[model samples]
Target chain A: MIETRGLTKTYRGGRPAVDGLDLAVPRGSVFGFLGPNGSGKTTTIRMLMGLIEPTAGTARVLGQPMPGAVRQVLPRVGALIEGPALYGFLSGRDNLRRFDAADPAADPRTRSERVGRALDRVGLAAAAGKKARAYSLGMKQRLGLAAALLQPRELLVLDEPTNGLDPQGMREIRALVRELAADGTTVFLSSHLLDEIEQVCTHAAVMARGRLVTQGPVAGLTAAVLGPGGHGRLAVTTPDPADAVRVLKEHGLTGLRADGDRVTGELPEAPPDGPAPPDPAELNAALVRAGVRVRAFGTQRPSLEDAFVRLTGEGFDVAG
Target chain B: MLRADLLRSEIATTFRRWRTLVLLAVLAGVPVLVGVAVRIQTGRHAGGGGGPAFLAGIAGNGLFLVFTALAVTLPVFLPMAVGVVAGDALAGEAHTGTLRYLLVAPAGRTRLLCAKLVTVVAFCLAGTLVVALSALATGALLFPLGKVTLLSGTSISFGEGLLRALAIAGVVALSLLGVAALGLFVSTLTDSGVAAMATTVGLVLTAQILDGIPQLQAIQPYLFPHYWLSFADLLRDPVYLDGILRNLGLQALYAAVFGSAAWARFTTRDITA
Candidate 1:
């Protein structure tokens, strides 16, 4: 478990990077930190990992006071912050061994075997022997993950773990994060990609301009209430576009757009408690009343991307 | 334990670098060149008539000169390299992003710094040993083995000269430790290896400059490079211990103070990488 109470961090000669934030990540859950660039995501993770001190407030990891109890807390936590740093001349195995020196009493053979398994887990067993400099960006990121997994820890903190990854690499990383969470390790990750977070994270927190807007399970976030039709993609096909607009406006549903024979618009994440839709059962009744014939009507569920954009006000592309 | 691991890791990494090999090869060959040059020069000077004692006397006087030159020059050239190698031990990793992995493991900052310091001191010792071994071989071949004359005009045996050379080498190694500590301290403040190396070298050169100024003579003993040649006093009749011991004490003081300061900085440092 990780908890921060009113935590704040202000960079010297600069504005507060993380401002008066309160956060709690339950154990054994994949918690995603969502924010755009310069949104204080990295700063929060750094403070949680004891890389930097908080300007005010207190943070605890696994029930220990941050940084002050770092020596004890760190052994139980594993993290990869910022970009991966590696020794170009040393192979992946050698890199692990160097840090493994923290526990010198461990059996070298067992350590090597654990390293091999981690390499396999990250799907880079074939490239483990090659110098890190020879590996691609994706391979290096996986190697960084492997290093984090060399020894088991209760909490794993990863910042933008999937950045710069291709489709296959992204999948592998997503799978690894899932597997880690499945093994009962608390995974706290930060990413701007809502799709990635939606795929793996069970809970989430959004940050905007250094202050946390809100946080909770991804499913529970109440999308802004939309009137009658709902706030999601609705496909309406009509022979007459002019008639559909008139009908929709009369029903009090605004923000409508038309392309060719179809008039389309979104509802809200949550349907407003106003009036019900003209009732698909009454589609014929409504069409006849408005002097138009409705060919078809279908509703598309709002994606996690739309939910994120609505919550954070940051325009995002679904395909990305 | 981290110190031992760091030492082993540093040894493996530093010894394998092309630069280190080139340095070792060059350093090892110095005595051989000196021997050949002495043999040729003295053979011509003697008109092929002098006995081995004359040659031995000539070599003894020249051997200290060789030792002195190696001591003074290697401290400047080689320890700066040691400083560069050791200074980057942590800062280099931080700059490149490897430090995050290490830190997340939550290894004690004290242990890691200790490890880096020991590795650098090892390099310093190895560098001085190279000079000692090279000079010993050159002294054996270029002149007679027995050394009966001292700089104070007294006399001792060839075995005594060899022993003194070894002692002198130890002193040189201790002096270099001080240089290594200075580098490591600077290492804690930076993330750029090039910047750390440049800063360490600049500091060393500055100390050397201060040591050389006549007006700074009173403060010279405090400078790291000042007593680098004090090992020569060991070759005197009574074996002058004043300057050599004082140099060792000062080096010890530097190593302790700088090493502790590095630990303090490292523990409080915010490792962004």
Candidate 2:
């Protein structure tokens, strides 16, 4: 639903904020734009929304060239850029009404009904009569979400949609996103929270320092970091730590370490210097044969956070 | 294509603000203050002269109060009120970050600009009518009402004088289009509403001061405020159209120039705020 070709934005006398980004957001997919702060996610989103023109490239939203086609394309796209910007003096309901009125395509006769429904969807219906200035940060975030949902959109571009929400609010927003995706709306979400992307996104693009590091399905990203068979490290909790370590080493597990009664080591898949990795069942049997009193045996799978950190060469705020 | 709903929304939002109400209240209060002051001065000294153009005639015919109040406020108070409203039109939205929402609502840039200009022009008419109505009511209460003597010394019926008064109010309102357009142009240049308002009002004051200088007479006629007081000629026997037409024409020139300038700057400029 959204595509960009060599999209770059360079401020005067400064490095490009968003550099040569070629992004594709498929229709009806929950695409997560994963990046750290100042990684050009918002800049790219702004360019896509046509709020700011890209200095040197082109962005097509909904298959129409942006800025030039803004009048034609924007009515079908809903956006919440940066945060919820509202008129503090106006009540939340009035705010929605005003925005609804701004859209020439919005049906005037059904405006009030739609605004009320949107407010209810964001859980702001009770507070609709109150001035937006009196709303809390989380409420404001929800109101911004309400604005994006005011009109049924073909594509929803949200920048940091869950930024100021509590844990419950965040969960609610995530659920709302899932629901919207289920209805076939293309969602382009950007955030620094790795957990959010992992929990909600079907596809994601990782960006670092204005450059795209990688992009694909979330499962594939984690699997890529895990290598073949998707195995990471094997941990064995046993009474005989030395015996367990000796057996694990004999089984060709690399980087064996023992602490107290636990032993852990890398379960390399198809190691260049060794035979293929043994099945976990056979490894458990080998430990049992060594007379190690095994309490628990498991292979740890790599997480999306680990994959993202490795791919971006930087740490992300893993929790929202 | 101007959307009626959007225009209604703009008008509603602009007028609903306490700031706008206060500006109108101040405008309404001006006529009362002038009426009461003239009533007191006429009672104290029997003859009123050397105050303002129409102040001396208020005691004889209450209708003159409308003319007097408009004359008193037109040069400063009226345009200043319009300056506040027009200058804040776009910049205020930018300051509050509502401009982005409005634009992305697909309120076409040109259409939104048109809506803002229409709202500001509406304010101009509303402000002028407020002063005129307040003066008329206060005039009726404080003094007698009857025939009005024109500036050419010909007496006209009270109804004709009232029609002339409405026309004069209209002329006064049209006289402000230049300031309204100039303020809108200034609004597009900044994201700070206060800065835009101050700059617009400051420009008006500077132009008025320049129009007053004898040394600047060569360019005085080109200033937007040069023909502002030409509405007084409506009181002439034949109702002189020369200065009134010139005033309207000059305002149209400023409106066209600044209106296009605003459109150019607003449509092309980035909306980062």
Whole-model Cα lDDT of every candidate shown, in order: 0.75, 0.91
Which window of 10 residues has the lowest lDDT sum in candidate 2 chain B?
B43-52
Off by over 4 Å in 1: A103-109, A222-231, A246-255, A266-297, A314-320, B1-7, B18-23, B29-69, B72-75, B138-148, B153-157
**Each candidate's DockQ:** 0.51, 0.71
lDDT of 1 by residue, B48-158 (tens): 434322233444454553464365445566677677776777778788876666666665677667767777877778877887677666765656556546768887776
lDDT of 1 at B65: 35
lDDT of 2 by residue, A1-320 (tens): 88888999987898888889988888889999988888888888878877888898889888999989988898888889889899888999999999989999899888889999999999999999999999998999899888888889999999999999999999999999999999999999998888898999999998888878788788887787655645577989988998888888888888889998888898867869877668989999988887888999998877788888777776864222
C-alpha RMSD by candidate, in order = 4.2, 2.7
Writing each residue's lDDT as its tens digit, candidate 2 over B1-273 gives 437989999999999999999999999999999999988888788884788798889999999999999999999999999999999999999998899989898898999999999999999999999999999999999999999999999999999999999999999999999999999999999999999999999999999999999999999988999999999999999989999999999999999999999999999888888
Pairs in clash, predicted candidate 2: none
- Tens digits of per-residue lDDT, candidate 1, A52-78, equal 989999999999998788778887777
Q: How many backbone clashes does candidate 1 have?
A: 7
What are the chain A TM-scores of the candidates, in order? Answer: 0.85, 0.92
